[model samples]
Target chain A: MSEHGTTLNIEKFGSASEAKALSAEADDWTLIIRPQTGWFDLHLADLWRYRDLVTMFVRRDFVSFYKQTVLGPLWFVLQPLLTTLTFTIIFGNLAKISTDGLPKILFYMSGITAWNYFGECLTKTSDTFNANASIFGKVYFPRLSVPISIVISNLIKFAIQFGLFLVFYFYFLFRGSNIQPNSMLLMLPVLLLLMAGLGLGSGIIVSSLTTRYRDLRFLVQFGTQLLMYSTPVIFPLSSIPEQYRWIMIANPMTPLIETFRYAFLGTGTVSWGMLGYSAVATLVIMTVGILLFNRVEKTFMDTV
Target chain B: MSETVIQVRDLSKRYRLGVIGGRRLVDDINSSMARLLGRQDPLAKVDLLPGADKQKAARSDEMWALQNVSFDVEKGAVIGIIGRNGAGKSTLLKILSRVTAPTTGEVRVKGRIASLLEVGTGFHPELTGRENVFLNGAIYGMTKAEIRDRFDEIVEFSGFEKYIDTPVKRYSSGMWVRLAFAVAAHLDPEILIVDEVLAVGDAAFQERCLGKMEKVAGDGRTVLLVSHNMSTIQQICKECIMLKNGSIHKVGAPGSVVSEYLSETRVATNVDLTQWQDRTGNGFAKLSRMAFLNADGEEAGIFPIGTTICFDLETTYNRELIDPLFEVIIHDPAGEPLMHLRSEHDGLRIGKVNGRTSVRARVDNVGLYPGRYFVSARIAAGGRNVDFPRLCGSFQVTPSPGRHGDLRLNPKWGKYHLDSTWTRGDQ
Candidate 1:
């Protein structure tokens, strides 16, 4: 058994050295709570220990979202399908926007498939604090579990949407429509990681800010919609004016969508340098987001 | 040699008062700019400005929820934290549970800590009982394998095995509370922090919860509990901490600490109700003052058993009121209503009342046990509440020799005493 000796030191005051000396014998203490922790106090070990909670949250979200609905998980496939059809009609046919000689339906479906995952992760994770405030107020769990679970749960929906895209891609291929499947298609996992990273990174940053300034919630709602226009989701990046192409390239999501289309449809822009830049940007945002989120999680209970 | 399972040193938590969103972004920017320029905060409180005469800012916007509270919990000890509302009991528990960080000082804890600030912290209404059990268990930091091992025991304990597959939203509110409490009861952490979760469910369930808690305490885990129920605290806790105005007022054996707390609360009851802000009603009429009177109409604060007691309420109204029902409810120290006295129930009819009227309800024999009881008064007219004030005032009941002769009445028997006659029947 560990030592059970009682130590009383109520008279000691304003002595940082004594406190440090006590804390330095840290192997005996399972946890030491203080007023302010460093920015990098991410508590990754605690997060790992609470990984089951993250899985449970993901399960609850997936099961409860489609509980009574007749369509159920079918909505996951239908959502992207309907969105792709609408984009095909408005942006491709009516607006006279070129799909770079690829089939409009397949081109839009490919981009939508990739964009939907990032969009869902960003929008849902951004509301992590507000949506789970009641549970957060009552219990002490890794607050990051909620957003991380959201990203994972949305992956299931992404899979369903990706399967739908594959069905259409094969149908066009067997019909002799001009589409190429190439080695670049192996970048699918890396591209997915980049999207998840960018989404989670910016999502938590906004979630942390929203705890104090509620006005940011409204901004996030429309901000995602405005952001999709900058990416190559509805339109091809190659069609933009040469001088003005940098505007679209500035968005981290731009290269991700462009590369996803080029890999599958073999018609959109894909550059190693741009993809590398997007990867670097994701890393930076993720680091900043996690740090800000850690800082806010400790004290947001009071403000939120 | 008892181990100190938890040590809290100079722990304090400061909360900013007023609306959390009261300050605009412009004010935040201006303050940051001023701070960056090595000047005082531009938007700080007037007293906190550069030229303030006070040694400390003492900003009115700030309030310390917990101030310099230090204590240690030995393993196998059940410690009860008792205080009035806003006395910082919850804040102390919150800090210890890590729901929020303290503003200063530190707390070092050994072993795993599971805090049940509420019974069903993460119970989703749409999930089935069985699913929620696993979910709630995981939320309490239990793994899936651990939950699976004890899932049967949990289901049987909740007495919801038949309804285990049904969604929680479909269950009755009582069933939901039972299921939630069952999950909480099975948490076997080294340190258990509970905050008034025993107040939920029915009386029998509360008893079962207390029994479970006793078993937990008996298992030699460190338990920290916050509750207003003095009896439970005194019965379960070997030691008690009394909090007053965000600081520890006393810490000792449960019996003495509870009595001290009760005595202090007795003195804190307000006699004048006009300025009491904690009230709810439509506000057509208001209760101003309350006085306890004896049989001879003499003002008194204490009355012995079997004696006539009257509660006189001084009331005021802005306009004439008709057929107003005057009601008074007596509650025990735990805020549980023991008796209700209503004019309508007694068939008393008051035709009309104007501004500044007094109402009195007289009891022929005050059969209450000897202890302090609070009064909640309400005046209703035309199917609507004119005024309602809860715990407006308190009075004491003293023990007296009744038909039982020299045996004093024990409050543990119950809150009321009934007149009875015993006789031998011829066979």
Candidate 2:
């Protein structure tokens, strides 16, 4: 709202009079920082106002990943690649988990690529409170910009890893390796959303809890690793006995990974009711996560 | 009508003591279990405030860092918040900046605010100076285009142009602070809040920063400056708020408020270092007392110009010291370093003070311009700082009324007036 400074005369900022006009109309939107709010309160408009900060945070995360390394962005590609190869051997060849006649590489790579997106998001957003306490202690920005940026930056990593999976998919297709296409493949975007929403929700919850008890941090890392087993990343859901299959289906992540596998590999189960349940559960967790996150962001500085 | 850029009402902050604020799982479980069994929680309460009432304070662990403190700021006012350590200056800034919420009360602001509570924060060591400028700018809420528009100016101001593309990790810590402050100085927010962390910058850079702050203040942006340097605050700020024990003690022109701050609550001056209770160094040695001596070997609070001004540091050693070194730093009233006298610098190793011992340092022909000056004392055994009081005590170098010639000292012109023979002949 300061239009008189020479700073506004800078070319990219447009005219000082424009800021005057804007401030004149925005008279009633004064931001009042209060001590308390309802658990669900969020300054979404303020977050929108700090969009530049979100972009900057994302850019920082993107560029600072591979400093001093010979292979920078290549790590994005190699992480899922190495994990997929390891899964193909440890579970596919050794334990003999069925991929329902789908190519082992294709089946396992998709799962890792899909789940890794959520795991990366979870890990980064979980550290949002602890890692940024110094900066948070100094300046005031919409704190949510931090966790949101983690999700956006992890989205970029997911896209690159997803592209690597695509290359292998086409290579197997040329080799006629029985990787089939089905109408369910169109469900990929929805499945991706469920993954992101679930990841962000659980992440902020853990992050919020860790501000009080740091013991949750160790649990978060171990929990994310253990969660993959419950979600069927290595083995398809059909490989399990029907009586025990319900245990995997009970996990909020199972239906998402299962559906992703079903859509691409055309060999796994997909239930409309289970998908609905996953979406509903994700919504509930997300609401709870955001409420707890907002509560913690208010005074975490003192405790942190 | 002119706007009130920031307004606050009944602001307060409470913090718990005896814990790191990280409550362990066991503690949480024990508390919950007590609640379930209808028993009282062991960590029920404690008074954490610096000055709290006796009976209630005895029962609670919570500290009220700020208590019912409130003030309003008119648009474009350059106000200084001055306080000693633990006076809640930083906490008040944190609340105003919305970095943390108050335990009670509310703050309303009418414009975008940019605050820097710490210097060189958010600077990635691996990022280049160019990238960090943009990165830190954006972190402060400036858009990329804004940083791009001002990139040349930033690079030039930081004087890192020759190495702009090089990674910041290679830059010295001072260069990093310069770059960070350069980016923060250019913020175009409607309200600017700055903390004393700028003290980290060298004197020249700090001068430039104050000049820039003055220009920004003139540009009609409200500025709230916090610092322990009374002179710097008085130089730039028209009005000041002096905080005492977490409340506003006075709000008036900088001159009166600063004098009030100086006279009544000078932290530790002339106190024998041994009895200086706010020490954080190991218990091996204590600065017992600081003695200001005149030419007659008697204690003196005032000295004439061109005289040897001597101060004796009496330190009581709890443990035997090795190669014990003493250091004294004198600063002008403006908080600028005028001299650093170190026993080690003089190639003298005064060893092993088993008990009460004294070291004396003298500035011969104390050609200092006649004005106010203060000294900070330090003792380092081996290489670690032992007893370093920021302000040991203040003294006046009163001008001799009939003093003339090259010795006609002008305190306003410079801090020191060294002895030199003037030869004004044609040669």
lDDT of 2 by residue, A68-169 (tens): 568999999988889889989988999888888889999999899999988988988998899999898888778888888999998999999999999998
Q: What tens-digit string does per-residue lDDT give for candidate 2 at B215-255? A: 99999888999987776787789889887767777778899
Report iRMS (Å) of candidate 2: 11.8
Model 1: per-residue lDDT, tens digit, A68-117? Answer: 67899999988888998899889888997988999999999998999999
DockQ, candidate 1, comes to 0.38
Best by lDDT: 1
lDDT of 1 at B38: 98
Tens digit of lDDT per residue, candidate 1, span B325-404? 99999997667898999989989788888888887899988888877788888889999988888987777777888776
Residue A35 in model 1: lDDT: 92
**Clash counts for all predictions:** 0, 17
Runs off by more than 4 Å, candidate 1: A1-27, B19-57, B268-270, B294-303, B406-413
- Per-candidate DockQ vs. reference: 0.38, 0.32
Best by TM-score: 1
